[model samples]
Target: MALVNTKEMFKKAYEGGYAIGAFNVNNMEIIQGITEAAGELKAPVILQVSKGARAYANPTYLVKLVEAAVAQNPDIPITLHLDHGPSYEMCKACIDDGFTSVMFDGSSKPFEENVAEAAKVVEYAHKYNVTVEAELGTLGGVEDEVSVEADKAMYTDPEQVQDFVNQTGVDSLAIAIGTSHGAYKFKPGQDPKLRLDILEEVSKRLPGFPIVLHGASSVPQEFVNIINQYGGNMPNAIGIPESELRKAAKMAVCKINVDSDIRLAMTASIRKYFAEHPDHFDPRQYLAPARQAVKDMVAHKITEVMGCDGKA
Candidate 1:
């Protein structure tokens, strides 16, 4: 099977009460890990590229890598998406470059400007049969090229959701429900809660329309402990609880963004490998185990959290 757009996938997920995992891809191992796990579980997946990831790994290489994954796993559905595209031009460029889905992240812009730019990108993307995702509110924390201070982050105003959707015609709406970017989503002893009231209101207004959640990774404590024990410092790193995400999946949220968890898993494995074997200088010697760790993490998320393990 070839790469697919999210239109049909989102429709199915909306009716099925589950959300597809949108994992950010950086290199070959990360892509391999995510796709392998999703394929094994027969789950539909989205391999998304962030601006930083595009800068790190060339855009063409990432797109071809996703194509290769599709060739390897012909049964599971996969969508290549641009995560948080900053400008109309960037979104258009990705659409032209064969991304089946693109996100125009104008959340930080003025409301009217954001709607106008998103609408522009939507118009362009629709012409190419590419789905567009637009963010309604800013999510805080640093990951890739997306960074917003906590003071600047705001919960998506439920009142504006309908207008935003009607004006932009975005294929999916990413709303800020208290989840932030990166592993440190919440501070120690702070309650990590999603604004389900806001989610409820958005669902009431948008009914069957697909919704998206950014910064949805539940950072596994095992990885954090392993990294810290093996000469790494990721102190007080936290993430959304899996239970909350499961509830969100049952709502209109048909797509969930995850990146930091994969990073944590790979980093922990590599750290442990290096600490145990000081003589292994070859990249494969360490990267192989790191890739396996990522695969395991993704499999766990699909089966336990997202509940899309066999929905492919």
Candidate 2:
């Protein structure tokens, strides 16, 4: 099947009480791993590219990689998306380059500025049959180029959701409800809590409109342990609990972004392989296991947190 926009995917997820996994992709192995897992699980998946990712892997290469994935996994639905597009030009570039969906993250801008810019992107994106996602409120932590201090993080105002959606004409809304942007979402002794109350209120206002959650990866302890054991020093790297993500899925959240988990899994596997076999120098030797780790992590997410295992 050809790549599709999030419109139909989100609709089905909303009605079926599940959320599609939006995994960030920056390389061939990561793309292959995520698509392979989604294909096996018969789940719809969204492969996203951030600005930093575009810089790391050229836009043309990223698009071609995703296209190859679609060709390889013809049975499952896949969407190519631009995650946290900083400007209309960026969103337009991705849409023109064959992205099925684009997210204009103007949350850091003033409310009016955000609405205007997002609306402009929506106008351009819809003309090309590409769906747009907009964010309201700010998330804490760092993901690629996105970074906000915890003190600056703010919960989305439920009342503003209706206006943003109406004015922007975005296909989905990503709201900040306590889920931060990166691996260190919380402190060592602090408890991680999502304001489901904010989600509830936003749902009531928008009714059936699709909602999205950024930084939704539940950083698996096993992967963290593996990385630490193999000469990595990531301390207190926590994430949203799976139970909370499942709860969000049962509500209006139709799309959840997961990036750190994939990175950790791949890094851990590569570190372990190199540590145990220092004699190997072939790139494929280490990448093979890293790819497998990505596949395993994505499969676990599909069946566990996303609840999108068999919903294709």
How many residue pairs clash in each candidate at the backbone level?
A: 0, 0
Residue 45 lDDT in model 2?
Answer: 99
Residue lDDT tens for model 2, 44-124: 999999999999999999999999999999999999999999999999999989999999999999999999999999999
Q: Where is model 1 poorest over a 10-residue stretch in terms of lDDT?
A: 230-239
Give the 10-residue window scoring lowest on summed lDDT in candidate 2.
184-193
RMSD versus native structure for model 2:
0.8
How far residue 14's Cα lies from its native spot in candidate 1, in Å, is 0.8
Each candidate structure's TM-score, on Cα atoms with residue i matched to residue i, is: 0.98, 0.99
- Which pairs of residues collide in candidate 2? none
lDDT of 2: 0.94
How well is each residue in 1-312 modelled by candidate 1, as lDDT tens digits? 888999999999999999899999999999999999999999999999999998899989988898899999999999999999999989988988899999999999999999999999999999989999999988999888888998999999999999999999999999999898998878778889999989999999999999999999887889889998988788876789989999999998899988999999999999999999999999999999999988998998898878899998
lDDT of each: 0.92, 0.94
